[model samples]
Target: MQQQRLPLALFLSLFGFACAGTARADAGSARLPDWRVSGFGTIGVAHAGEREADYTSSVMKANGTGATRSWSTDVDSRLGVQLDTTLARRWSAVLQVVSEQGLDNSYRPRIVWANVKYQATPELALRAGRIALPVFLIADYRKVGYAYPWLRPPVEGYNVMPVTSSDGVDATWRWSAGPVRNASQVFYGHSAVPLVDSLHLYARHGVGASNTSDWGALSVRVNVLRADITSNIGQDLFDAFDAFGPAGQALTARYAMDHKRMTLVNVGASYDPGTWFVMAEANRAISHSFLGATRSGYVSAGWRWNTLTPYVTWARVQAVGATLDPGLPTAALPPALAPMATALNAGLNSLLMRIPQQTSFAAGLRWDLRTNMALKVQVDRVTPHDGSTGTFINPTPRFVSERTSHVASVALDFVY
Candidate 1:
């Protein structure tokens, strides 16, 4: 993998040349050198109109923009950088990276957050290498698209659980309850990603808990997680249903994907109050292999008008358990293995149609143009149910699964 990212890019270029030689030896010192550096970016383009699938905003992307062409910048370009250091009295540290377009489509740069913290007092704090997986509610700035006003983040509620970061350890606490203010957290981690074809997705042990609260302009959040995942991305259709003996080993033990057991739950809320704003969230997921259950949500609203804002959103995802099953029957099979048991029950119900039902509606506009820039435009209008093909991607074969797609986007965000 590019020589393991060259030692995290030479340790972030030797910590940015030792924070630029401690700010040129504290140039006329007035105190301000404990280290800091920041960045964020996006320059995007998108278009889709269902050209037979391919409009992705993560499924760990492998292709995007209707039929993979017409228009796309891989759905959203990206760039990031960060650093924060203090490393002493109560310690502190962080490191970011980013550089988008992955799942082997390359734009490399990884390592999102390097972590190290400890401020064990005034309301606790603690961390360890690589963290961030709050599971939702802008999950730690959701890739900083100029700090949100949409052009993303509603892939049916952030694509269910696209997991972002995890290595191990976390702790947080913060207080105040009178006029509300809180920040609970707890974690333990493990993760591995890489999807699409060569597949990989592991999430071991991973534990979680989250909470957030505020009162002034209202805010709320809640989260829970569990893990013990594993993947083989359809090992040859569960080894052709384990060669059909005990009902093909009982359909590869009721839907393969090995070490299963996944669970997630989330809740969110927002309500700005400066001009206007609103947000909502919901989630649910359970697994018994083939990623069985699901339920997603989204809601957004905006209106600011000074530097433009205008927004709207409503999303959905639904597939609450079992999207088809019933394999290995082939009528008393024996007629020469009955066409290989009806082609392994039609390739395991066509891989359970990838379990995603959909609905989307969006509208956007954001202009902020300064103070770290922003500019956006959006449109969505998905729609896929029953014959699901929602999170589109590489369909073709005249792919028309309950057609209804329309995507449009434009972006230019920045931060520093």
Candidate 2:
């Protein structure tokens, strides 16, 4: 497995103490400490109908099904463990570790949350260290399958940007007025995320805020964030560009990925009253880099009848091209440099074209097997726009333009 050895021991120590509490409970039920340990996981199988490309939940993953394709366990299966306990009268900590398919296509455990929290009063609190980014409605608990009504979150919306956590400090304030309860959170942090095999992204000087309000069965949220972004483009491509002299320099300057600013905004609302529920959310991620701009959203509704619940979802991600020019003039360049200019323009267009433009419709049924477990089956029809591949990776020449792919998945989700 591709393990991040650093900080593994620190996370293990926190989990280790939680395990000791369990051991004490086994030895003497009354002697157990306040430490609590819990976990959630999904055993899933997925298949795709298209053979020219592989379908995946995230762009970071390298594995999926295609021509050599069949059912695979790597698509949605995952396991996570969390430890929560009090350190002092007003101080507490949380540690969470997860093992799932990642950028390296391995199940190695990674620390998801390792933070200390201090409660100053009933209405205010502070936290520091690695913490979840409140970038979406379910940002903090997106991995916990039992917490949501669907088999999985709409990939088009959730996969827009894969970095989920930041390393720094955050604070929350709570208040209530009449029948409405509200909480506001503000945070500042930095992060590094490995995307695919060649793109390693870094976010610096990041700051964000999230506000949520609840009234009866209705809940609403708004979030905004900004950060300075940088990424390591493929080394081979970098060298090729570097060799092209001023032309390459101009191309790199137009992209301006290093230290460029990125902004994200989100709005979401949901209403649930026991028997039925409806939800909708929208997000915009804009940047000056090659990552470009993405606008995504999803709407879902479900009706619960006894132990069975059926749901439907519609989601899509639309790519917005950048406004900057590549400095490749068609008529002004010399004869010797015409070929280079053409190549640069073509490369720029290819990068812009790769941004996803996909729409998907999904239907699923969830069966409550027990208090903490559920069985689910889902089917999705995904259609790409303008010859884009949507969420599919490793595209081949056989991939048909504007073709729709059908994907089916079955999963058992449980928590304890």
Candidate 3:
């Protein structure tokens, strides 16, 4: 794996070096007509009513509100700066860096986008380097808090796939059909992201396509993606299973996260007139490994009263495949190994319980403080179902799976 990553690491290093050199070269010049710089940030805090588990925005975060802390800024605080430059009439480039709370519990600046684009024609464009994956309707702007009406996108649907970008190439074509305008994109790439517990998620041989259409105030999108994913999140547990001979091997083969294939399908739509807006999205994840299969969706609507927008959202995530598996009949084992067998079986079942099955209802109000700044306050009632802990992390012994948690959040978003 290290060898495979060498090329990408070298490419990124060279790209950064070139960009830095360009900046230094342009410093002596008075005006840079081809260069543009912009930035965005969010200052936020959240508190979760449940004390036994932490409520995190995504698995990439190490800790969040509730048990970890009374109020946490890691759930939403972030800063991003982007530089765009036109290299030529047909060539352009963009570099964006973001600093946010990461799985290692640090606010490290990472490259969110570093892509060069070639304008093939009036309606076609090609790009190479790290590009954002268009997995959902608002995926391209999900990190820009000021661009959206909610404090954050619904976690139930957005957190299913934590990956944000990939290293590869993509092509986009835009055309107008009658009264509707359409944009279609096709991409191929691979991604690797670090997670908590020293685990890493890798998606190889990823391919995807998406299309979006806009007509008046209405917009709709559909996307399909597939990849071979691997993770070592539960290495210790799987290693123990490997010790139990063929039965244990079979169990590991069925549940281990070893180069498993996963497919994702997403459909979304939105309508925004001047005074009001409504948006909804649905996602389906198919996998045969321990990740299982899931159906998730969310619906949101808001009324714009002057500069204040009040919005309500309902979201749900359910496991559609088997959440638990009967592994190795402990009773059939030898008397001396019965205890160990039973323990292993219990452990396997416990791991399976991590699958998310939850429902959330949220209401928020966004106050547009200025044309470039906004303040938001939101409250969510989250309930775990079917003994799943939902998206909460760091569960303690006192954690109850079916318990409901109420979270309150406030955020200030700005762009400049």
**TM-score against native, each model:** 0.34, 0.88, 0.93
**Residue range with the least summed lDDT across 10 consecutive positions in model 3:** 1-10
Cα lDDT tens digits, model 1, 67-148, are: 8798999778889999888844565668888888977788878887776666779799887767779989899989888898
lDDT of 2 at 70: 75
- Model 2: pairs clashing at backbone N, Cα or C within 3 Å: none
How many steric clashes does model 1 contain? 0
Q: Native-vs-model 3 lDDT? A: 0.88
The most accurate candidate by lDDT is 3
Residue-level lDDT tens digits of model 2 in 1-416: 12244334444554465455456546654443368899999998899888888887767676776544678788888999999876544566788888888877778778878876777898999887778999888888988888888888988888776788887789999999899999999999988775665667889999999999999999999999999988876344445565667867666765747788999999999999989999999989898877778899999999999989999999998887653345566477678978876776676666665667899999999999999999999999988887566767777867774888899999999999
lDDT of 2: 0.80
1 or 3, greater by lDDT? 3
Query: For model 1, what is the error of residue 414's alpha carbon versus the real structure, in angstroms, after optimal superposition?
Result: 8.6
Deviation in angstroms for 62 in model 3? 0.4
lDDT of 3 by residue, 170-267 (tens): 99999999999999999999888866556788899999999999999999999999999899977788888899899999888988889999999999
TM-score winner between 2 and 3, please give it: 3
